[model samples]
Target: MRLAPVRDDVAGFDAGEAAAFDPQPVRDAGGSGERITSLTSWWHTRWCQVCGHTFRRGDRVLVADSRVRHLDPTLDCAESGGGRADEAEVVRFTEGLLATWPVVGDVPLTRTDDVPGLLAPPLGGLRRAACLFCAHTFRPGEFVVMCPCTPAARVCARAVHRDPARGLPCWESWRPGSTLKVCPVTLTRLAT
Candidate 1:
């Protein structure tokens, strides 16, 4: 049985190890005091599945899972040596972790003013999110990034660059952020 890891990260983790700084989200007054934006950042180490290399920052590497699995069907993902996984499964795993991982950040103040309601969710105004790299849809488990650039922009670090001419669809790039960074695969698809 492929067990999904039990997790406490979706709610956000403490930036510091001290119990004093653990994320104890208080709901906003204007918005439901249920969800507050996380001030923490997200990141993952770059590793080569074939070579076992832990890449340093700014190293040219596969930054998205989509690109990784697609790039070489024979390559076992750096962490998946015990089993074989298909492209869909790999992408799904990446997507799930990105969505559920509790961020390490500060609790945002609840808005007492008119906070914009998300137009798409069945929950009336709950934050809606998508992968920054692939634009895959997800309902945010963490408070979605509501930057002035896009009030409802949900993001992930799974980015890729496309190479349509060479038939290399996309490759992972780097860390994710609150703002969307549409994958080249999607961009190429949209351009057509």
Candidate 2:
């Protein structure tokens, strides 16, 4: 079996000293951390698979395995090697490392109001969206109702002005006396 060079370690070893070195490949977070060394022979020098340079006495070189050859050419030691053999398996390995990665930047707070229960604008502000009924922009602090017509799979219709006193009579004009209250965005029939 070809040992996977999962451990990202670099070590230097003399010609005969590598025979004594016994390194282990990284399996998971709890894996034994060992440095992988590229051997330099007294009789002849070995060429690097990545940079095409001859391995000198103490050059830091990354060693690849059968698994590494399947990785992207930019990352792998083999220049022509490309495409992931198992993207899901690669994700599984990195997911553990990603857990330890530091969290950067604060998440923006959701904006809330008394009228809409639990439903709030994303990132403390409403994205500028026009009302399909009146062709008017839904401004901030405006009382608007999202069309309940859309299914869970599809994107919901644009918000219409609910409070006619504060804004344009969009909701009133859209609903009453219409044979079909189809959502302008999704073109789906409104749930009456």
Candidate 3:
């Protein structure tokens, strides 16, 4: 459907007068990695090779070397397509991995000029056969891994989800009038 052209006299157009225009309030997802006036964020959707789970824009997930593919169709780890590994197989991959390497969550990546290759697209590309969720950035003759993670471990994804109880889009930049930061779960109970 075509919308009426907006007028420069928007200030004079009150609610009833603008009804024919079908105006929509501006939205700021804030977490969509938009490059606003002065700030920019980097967040992208990725798939979990181990569980075949597709993570959304801001989810935190584990990553491992892509050379090793995990998660068979039956939810078991496998070195290759034909062979299956049991629960212990996952332990082999995820166990001491965290003890030695810290878990890296999905955070926005910004370009840095100081790092020789940080601003360049990952050398092998974001999806590489040898890398899980990310590719590689090289300096001179060496390969440098980007912000890293491992799929062998699980990180809770609840924080990445929008508030389920309120079912409202993000309002970090919106202030219709007055707002409160009350718990929606409690508000639901009080309503009934």
Which one is best on lDDT? 2
Give the distance in Å from residue 83's predicted Cα in candidate 1 to where it truly belongs.
27
The RMSD of every model to the true structure, in order and in angstroms, is 21.5, 25.3, 20.8
Candidate 1 lDDT, 133-168, residue by residue in tens: 333222112123333122333222222222222221
Q: Report model 3's TM-score to 2 decimal places.
A: 0.18
> Could you say which candidate leads in TM-score?
2
Candidate 3 lDDT for residue 35: 24
Q: Using TM-score as the measure, what is the rank order of every candidate, best first?
A: 2, 3, 1
The digit string of per-residue lDDT tens for model 2 on 22-79 reads 6544332222222222232221143333333233333223343311111224334444
User: Candidate 3: misplaced stretches above 4 Å?
Assistant: 1-71, 75-82, 103-192
Candidate 2 to truth, TM:
0.28
Per-candidate count of clashing residue pairs (backbone under 3 Å): 11, 0, 5
Model 3: clashing residue pairs? Answer: 62-150, 62-151, 63-149, 63-150, 63-151
Model 1 weakest lDDT span, ten residues long = 32-41
lDDT on C-alpha atoms for all candidate structures? 0.29, 0.39, 0.29
